[model samples]
Target: MTSDLRLSRFEYGFAQFMSVMASAPAKLEEKPKERTHQTRDRSREPHSRSMPFRNEMGSEMVDIYVGPEEEPFRVHKQKLCRRIPYFDKMFNGQFKEASENVGRLPEDDPAAFDVLME
Candidate 1:
């Protein structure tokens, strides 16, 4: 037989073998394993939540001076970013405010900023 004919026969045999293997049923183990430890009730367990305002003291804070009065306010950078996209960009983006950790808003009302921070 020629090399091409031999190769074709081998390929046909391989394909048939693969098809048979693919069609075979999967076998399960005869024995089952037991749990090593007891499962505890997770609902009763104490868990820490994202209480940003309550836990702000531990995190990094940013100083913001707003309005013509330049009324100063301090806020947690992370919590501020989470609620305000403008602050997020200003504090995270390649701006002077980001590096300084300080923001000045001469045009914005301090009362409005206070409401937002609260």
Candidate 2:
């Protein structure tokens, strides 16, 4: 009688454990439903414009010139001023280069500037 009672209890516990294990996989596999109010139209949004500055000469308004005499890069002042802190200070602050609109970087490599421009 005692053995039968213990066996019944063990069987009941095993059945409950197996039921939970079976349902866990189903719950994990189910995909979450998307919210109805979260519809967004990404295609209608306006794309950004291309860079106005280029490597070519006389293409656009050249605000500042950089690098050595042999290999100089013509870059936009507004773009540089906005992007680089060093350039912003030099161009905006009361300096000789601010008025001249020409910044010479003899020590700095021109290839680096080319990469930056690109």
Candidate 3:
């Protein structure tokens, strides 16, 4: 009788453990459902027209025309000044670039400028 009681207890405990293990996967599945709902909501949000480097409207205050006549990059002064110390000095200092609305980088490669801009 004592042996039967111990075996029954062990069986009950084993059944409970198995049930918990089975429910764990169900709980994991529920979590992904909630995440999918959140992802769908985020996807519905509007995206900005301007990218990290490119702005197409030509509305930026200043322009930097890089390279020779063959290739050029129209870059924003504020963006350049914010990123590079050399550009900040040239634009903020008492230089011709500061006076004029436009600046030129005749020697610099246009391809290199495109990479920097991106």
Candidate 4:
């Protein structure tokens, strides 16, 4: 007949072939495959943990000083010591003394100074 009629006939046959293929099952689905990994306890040392300090008492001071070149960061140390709970109370007296002795470590007592404006 015409080209449009031939195309419609081919489309009907293609559609029927797809429907039959979808109804058929593959032979691989009936076979059991081997697992590469073994089933182990996923809860131990990973998912669950028990911290000693989390249950018991914690330390008085936590020294976590990390600098650019391993040099002791005086500013961070001063800030960190202020948050030590009991140590913050000594801010007016002992903390002030400690702040005075910060950069004056035996060699630079006169480091705390302003330039002359003459």
Candidate 5:
């Protein structure tokens, strides 16, 4: 089995591989092609009206109360939705949390939530 594997591996010899690599360009020298689509000037639009959920822009914040004491933690809704599946469902779905923009986890540890935020 080992001999068969070795025979297959040697089918393309090291010399042939090296020769091909040597003939190839070290780096591509082509200039970047211009974008074909006309991008809308975002500067003219209001910041709040812009794409809020995009990674480059900051989204609305949400308040999540955790632990027995109900320690409140403020986090970006977009970040939470993008990173955590539970948050994504809760925020986007037809749930009370989506409407209120607040979440409660009375049993979950506040420290764990803090770590998650970090």
Candidate 6:
């Protein structure tokens, strides 16, 4: 039983990857492969109208464009801002998006934005 309880490193790694993939945002209807590949790493990249961020749960969290620490990055809220062409009408306000989620209100919602700051 104890032997069975342990998983090999490969198995562990595979499981971790699967979990990450499952959580990471994914496209619903497939698109041209080029576009799909380009936006894969949405978190740690520079700002672009093209970039989008979702968590390990296949939901849109934020549209991020990573930069430097001082000009560190630009994080955009979705509901107020425009959604990507393909992904529009998919998620509700602040749903299936960034890990930094908040209430179903506009980005300028004082309480919701406050939560995001923390």
Q: Can you give the TM-score per candidate against the true fold?
A: 0.52, 0.44, 0.46, 0.17, 0.53, 0.21
Candidate 1 CA-lDDT value: 0.67
lDDT per residue (tens digit) for residues 1-118 in model 2? 3454444433554454335434554554457677679766767655532222333222433344434654766777766655555666666668887887777666444545554554
Tell me how many clashing residue pairs each candidate has.
0, 0, 0, 0, 0, 12
* Whole-model lDDT, model 4: 0.33
Per-model root-mean-square deviation over C-alphas:
25.1, 27.9, 26.5, 34.3, 18.3, 16.9
1-118 per-residue lDDT for model 4 (tens digits) = 6555453433554454334334433422345567799886756564334455333333332222222333232333333333332223332235553445332223211112110000
* Candidate closer to the true structure by lDDT (higher is better), 3 or 6: 3
Clashing pairs in 5: none
The deviation in Å at residue 98 for candidate 1 is: 0.5
Give the 10-residue window scoring lowest on summed lDDT in candidate 3: 31-40
lDDT of 6 at 97: 41
Q: Write the per-residue lDDT of candidate 5 for residues 27-92, one digit (tens) a residue.
A: 223354687998777887777764544554256889999889999999989887766656766777
Residue pairs with clashing backbones, model 4: none
lDDT of 3 by residue, 40-72 (tens): 344655566345435532345666776676364
Q: Lowest-scoring 10 consecutive residues by lDDT in candidate 4?
A: 109-118
Candidate 6 per-residue lDDT over residues 1-118, each given as its tens digit? 3457776554654454335334333332235355344536557756664434332123334443222222222233443234232123223333454334332322123322222222
Superposed on all Cα atoms, model 4 deviates from the true structure by an RMSD in Å of: 34.3
Sort order, lDDT high to low: 1, 5, 3, 2, 6, 4
- Better model by TM-score: candidate 2 vs candidate 3: 3
Worst 10 residues of 2 by lDDT: 49-58
